[model samples]
Target: MILNQSVIVDIKDIIDKAKDKAIRLVDHQRTIMYWHIGKRIFEEEQEGKDRADYGNYLTKFIAEQLEPEYGSGFSKRQVELIRQFYRTFPIANTVYSQLSWSQYKLLIRLDNQDKRDFYVAETIKNNWTVRQLERQIHSNLWERLLMSNERESVLAIARNEKHMSDAKEIIKDPIYLEFLGLHREASYYEKDMEQAIITHLHDFLLELGNGFAFIARQKRLHIEGDEFFIDLVFYNRLLRCFVIVEIKTTKLTHQDIGQLQMYVNYYDRYEKKDFENPTIGILLCAEKNNAVVKISLPENNKTIIASEYKLYLPTEQQLIAEMKKEIEKHDYEMELPTS
Candidate 1:
């Protein structure tokens, strides 16, 4: 009674298709179920306008009743989450399938409507997983936008565009490298950190922001029999240029700036296409002497940059203090009389 070989193959294909369709159907159904639950909770809470204390007790009681009947999916905490979800996104049509409940929770916590909209748009545009969304949230992507000259422009692009145009557009200055899990005070060599970044390249790229693809590590360049090795090389499709990153474990110096400048020059002359933009060089260090950086680079310098990297996320107060210092410096410089 066994089927022939061709019949078996056909049957297997049909089964596979059926299973795929079933899984998709199940996902759709689950999404609908959650939306409905959220809606019901919202309506009930509105109806019991005077019963402020009753809401909590009612959710717990409902959870107790539903858990046994509907399995563990209806836990009290989850019910509360569902209620919050409804309150957050009243418009069911805006509930994207790509986002999970956890991501929604984070979005709801964002007080600024513009900031929340930017994250939601980016989340959908990038097809970011919940974990990626969480990482970006933790990295203070919204706050970083506030530092940009074109804050509104960037938000508009993020909201309306399908993909970013360049890595530079998305990359934050002084990128937070806290995910590296290195100690701030401990002595570490530049090569050691470079190696670590290469080893954990995926996570590093994620933290580097969007549109970056690793080209090589310790990419060798030959010029008239002299050999030079670039620490790390990447191509940013959005920027349409090669990005050269040099790591320094200590404070930045004029020498670091000069070295990066040379790398940018080399890439532009030998590596970059005629239509491509000039190669961009980044000098990443533990600390930077801003005066030294400004003096070392040409007044019209656009290809090279020096930025600090942190081994740990700064505390809220620390971030605020740093921001305040930057603002004060700007104000003081502005108020000073010109020579």
Candidate 2:
């Protein structure tokens, strides 16, 4: 007897899910096995005073025996990594079951415990793939977050210890768009960049931070018989607000901020519900003067943000310089007297 099409489809889905679960289980077991191996090596070293020689000898002997039975997985380098993994996470419970051995390998290399903890929390929260986690690490995402927020606040958000109330906590400056596949040297229009962003909206959302959902593009608004078009629009679930983005390919001017401010005001007044937070306006420009941005908006303005965008990934030195500039700006703001 022939089965119904729906039944066949359901069976296929079940089989696929089962296979995925099995793969995950095997991966978790492999990670646990490596941790146990590392623990045994550590235990062996406890009896010897010279840990250096003891570790070397232990790994070498293990590799000599295990390589004959297993394969390259039991090589001396692999054994050393396993030992380091155990050393990094001494407690078995700290080894997250959701993460694969490859992800753990990357986490073990980080010397800073806070940074490692942040990544662990984010990896679990976002369900990020190993490649995505590696990319975030390479992009210096943690350092970028620290540029605008305190270390503890950033970690708190990542760990779900605190709710995200401000966009500044998640929004990054000099937003990286290398995944858009646009050449830095090539001259492009704002529309072109917007199109590129929509084309790779998934990666853009990853770069935009968590809880962002794309809404509309070139959203039309008629105010007093005048037509205005918002370049891009988004809603941030965490912030509970509508996000208006205006793309400017050239250096930002005061007029750009005024236009964006108008859009934000329009959204807050007309588009937003009473329960929703104030709409946020973001000027995504190629270059922006911080002083100009500050002077254009009110001192207490929290709805408008001027963020620079880069077509390429920034170097470590560049990110450091950016962080220094942000700190200096923050200090300057702090020194100003309140009215």
Best by lDDT: 2
Q: In model 2, how many backbone clashes occur? A: 0
**Cα miss at 35, model 1 (Å)?**
2.3
Q: Each model's RMSD to truth, in Å?
A: 4.3, 2.0
Clashing pairs in 1: 166-238
In candidate 2, what are the lDDT values of residues 1-339, reduced to their tens digit?
976899889999999999989999999999999999999989988887455687788889999999989999989999999999999999999988899999999999987999999999999999999988998888888988888889999999999999988889999986888898989899888889999999999889898998999999999999999999999999999999999999999999999999999999999889999999999999999999888998999999898999988888888788778778878989998999999
**Judged by lDDT against the true structure, how good is candidate 1?**
0.80
lDDT of 2: 0.92
lDDT of each: 0.80, 0.92
Best by TM-score: 2
Q: What TM-score does candidate 1 get on C-alpha atoms?
A: 0.84
Tell me each candidate's TM-score: 0.84, 0.94
Which pairs of residues clash in candidate 2, taking residues 3 or more apart in a chain or in different chains?
Answer: none
